[model samples]
Target chain A: MTFLRDTATIFSREFAPVWRDPLSLVFTMAQPLLFLYLFGPLLENGTDTPGPAWQWFVPGILIMMCLSGPLMAGYFLLLDLIGGSMERLLVTPVSRTALLVGRTLKEFVVLLAQAVLIIGLAVPLGLDPHVPGVLTGLTLLVVFGIGLGGLSFVLAIVSAPGGELFYGVTQVVMFPLLLLSGVLLPVENGPGWLQVAAAVNPVTYVVEAERALFAGRFLDAPVLWGAAAAVVTALLGLHLARRRMARGL
Target chain B: MIHARGLTKTYTLKKTSVDAVRGVDLDVEPGQLVAFLGPNGAGKSTCLRMLTGLLPPTSGTARVAGHDVTTEAAAVRARIGYIGQKGGAGEAFRIGDELVTQGRCYGMTRRAARSRAEELLTVVGLDGMFARKPSTLSGGQRRRLDIALGLMNRPPLLFLDEPSTGLDPASRADIWSHILRLRADHGTTLFLTTHYLEEADAMAERVVVIDQGRIIADGTARRLKADLAGDRLTVTLHDPADVPRAAEIAAGLPGAAGLASDGPRLTLRVAAADRALPEFVRALDAAGLKIDTAESSRPTLDDVFLALTGRTIQDEEA
Candidate 1:
């Protein structure tokens, strides 16, 4: 019970800045909105997929937001570590797991709100609604986000006091993960090696699951694979992040 | 309220290992304000971190506020407040919100934390500035906010690392007054590290000096100065030829050491320059060596540091 309370405290503190500056929250969603309107239409007639572009493209955009949003969450942790705010918190009796969990909770909340806005906007653009499926897809997205955010925090701790490593690693790894996951374009037409690489990429399974769930397919193999990937990522990320927090930054 | 034995910390970075703190033992009674004095990179912050349970010791043990720092870190944390060297408030968060959050971290409920935040804001002279971001505050105001955050838990022990390092003199004095007031009001034990020698000498009840990962001196400032760096008495001779004779006469004086001569001037260290000066003067007169002028000066903490390590704290700071 104390852990939950501490997690809530941390979550509220982490979310306070965004709450005060609503404009910054909008700015965070701007890139996804841009992809939804501009690059989204490019897939309308160009792709061989059997559904309206909105159905196929909206879930991919949500996954994209999930990837970018949580992958960059560590930057704030890096700032706290560099500035001494994190150290101050560490000295307090707040549960260490709460510290990581609270920040990831903030990420989950932010991703949820963004996913809602993106889905709502896509509804008027000929996208059919699958209420339960969309809800589950959002759940999967948040689960994956929690994991990614945890990894980002782990990176932040490792790169602390000087955050150059955080920036360098994130920049180098983000695009490959996004691209190989087939978030923007399908890897089906690519060579066998590329498909194999995408097959191994956990993000690819998540994207496939998002597409399947959004199309109202509940029992697809992709859903199981994506759910497994997200759960595993979340468990690994939380374990590593909590261990790092416990060990001290 | 704090006790440690053989507390040590070593950092193994890549191939080279650095012993940041080696075999530190310390004890602090409740309500004692101890100023930890050391140069930069002297392991002052490292030792503080270990004591606060922020960093685990590589070996040894510390019990702060009745809990072992290693195994019972949370209990220790709950009973103490630590103000780090940097601004503790996040730049983006409101000062009041940060303080309240600190209170909440210690398990204070929302209503209680809010009231405590209001009270501490007034204590730190930051009343009505709850909405102000830390980035907008002046250096001194930011420091006060840090203090308010540290006090939110109302812990019996508070550790401040360089609490006034970058503040102006006026601000530094302001900080000291606040610290002294807090101690008086709550009898909170304060263990703070500081780079300013005068602040430590003027404010702290006891002083602990560390150098190169080892504690070299520990005592009251007065005692350390008197024992390690005695007062200096200098005399100007009527003739340069009399200086060598004056030096010999000065060495003969009881409790005199570090006798030196330069041209017509002579100087020596004595436990009390006031008592030794007149005796040395009479001896020089008996030898028929006249003195032009005599003066005595009391030693500062710097002098004590110099006597212990042969390097002034100011020189190390530079």
Candidate 2:
């Protein structure tokens, strides 16, 4: 009873800060759009600077979105942590797991909006959204958002100043992940070590999945790998965050 | 219901895990107001956190409401309401919403939550600010809301970490007044920690004093004070800065058995000051020290603390 009640209560209430803060939404969406509009095209259809622009670069862009999603979650969670908001929640008969689940569920709304904006921009840049392409893209975004939300919850725990020092650490960790995910260019041509890191990067799966979506078909290793990655990362992240929440994080 | 036996907490901060709470045993009954008195970082907060299941114990065990703190936390959580030293409610929502959600987490229906919220808002004297965000409320109002949030489920056991820390005198009075009302009305078991000794003296039924990770004394305030009778005296030293010198000056006197410094004031052991006063003064003059002002007075809780811990709580706080 506490778990069900707490999940509903936490989800409904916690979502407000994200929705109500106009600045949070504007700032979160702004930079991603600037890159989409200004730089997204620079890599389009063999600009002669390097290899296949859309083939390699698109996945990285999508992966970057996934990896960075939890950074947003980390920011809000840490405030609540230091502010004693999360500790108060722990005192309740609230469900430990529900705290993060509710958060991930709420972010589905933001994920949908991000997907629409991305697709809207993608169309102007001449990426055709065939029926299957659009459907697969939407599915991937759902998985991506949930996965990111869970990771952010985990990051938020470690980010707790008393525990993990999340702000400085996350900021630094986020950048290299973006570069290695190959959001700006292909990491395939980078050094062997960087190539390995990119390959192992969960965002790479997102990029690969997005590539499949853009091709008007979704199948093979990439889509399965992406979905699997999201599922595993979410479970792991939720597990860690729940431990912290349970132990009074 | 709470029982802790040899409870200890050691926190590992990268290089070292210092023991914050060490070998403490306590037993508390339901609906009693027990005050945890200590200086800052004297393990009061650490012990309270463990009792409420907020921090894991480094060693030993505690049971609250029949649930083991480490193994049965969710059950312990269900049976208790814990308001920490800092205001800990969700700040993004309206106060009414926050209280309602708290109620619902205890398995109450929406209508039930609303009725309960209404009752509590009125109880904490926050009726008009139901619709305002907690982030927008004044400090006193935020603290009131913190109490309301802790009480939403009508928890059988309540833990308040410094229930009064920062507030104007008026607000402190108002908050404590509300707290007394809640205790009378609900008979809720209460445990609170505070650095304010007077607050403890004024409100607490029993006082447990801890210092340097150990329980120095535990008894009713009256009993602790009674233990200090016939031996303590308040006297002035000629100079505040020369307290050490004054201590030696008082110590050499024949009947001055126990002597201690409390800032400019010196307290010494004497069975009857009237019999020993002339000789003590003559010895001070012989020692070439004039009394600025001196009186042998009845013992206070401050003296009680000093007698038990060998250091006053004020010095520990400093």
Candidate DockQ scores, in order: 0.89, 0.56
Q: CA lDDT, every prediction?
A: 0.90, 0.76
Q: Supply every candidate's count of residue pairs whose N, Cα or C atoms clash at under 3 angstroms.
A: 0, 3
Superposed model 1: Cα runs more than 4 Å off: A48-50
Question: Which residue runs does candidate 2 get wrong by more than 4 Å?
Answer: A18-27, A41-62, A144-147, A162-164, A187-197, A243-248, B15-17, B229-296
**After aligning candidate 1 to the native by TM-score, how far in Å is the CA of A52 from where it should be?**
2.5
Could you tell me which residue pairs clash in candidate 1?
none
True contacts kept of 2: 0.80
Each prediction's TM-score against the native? 0.97, 0.83
**Per-residue alpha-carbon lDDT of candidate 2 for residues A153-198, written as tens digits (9 for 90 to 100):** 7766776656456766777777876777667876766799999998
lDDT of 1: 0.90
lDDT of 1 by residue, B1-318 (tens): 989999999999898999999999899999999999989999999999999988899999999999999999889999999999998999879888998899999999889999999999998998999899998899999999999999888989999999998899899899999999989999999999998888899999899999988899999998998899999999999999888878888887778899888888888899888898889888889999988999999999999999999999889878
* RMSD to native, candidate 1: 1.6
**lDDT for A161 (candidate 1):** 81
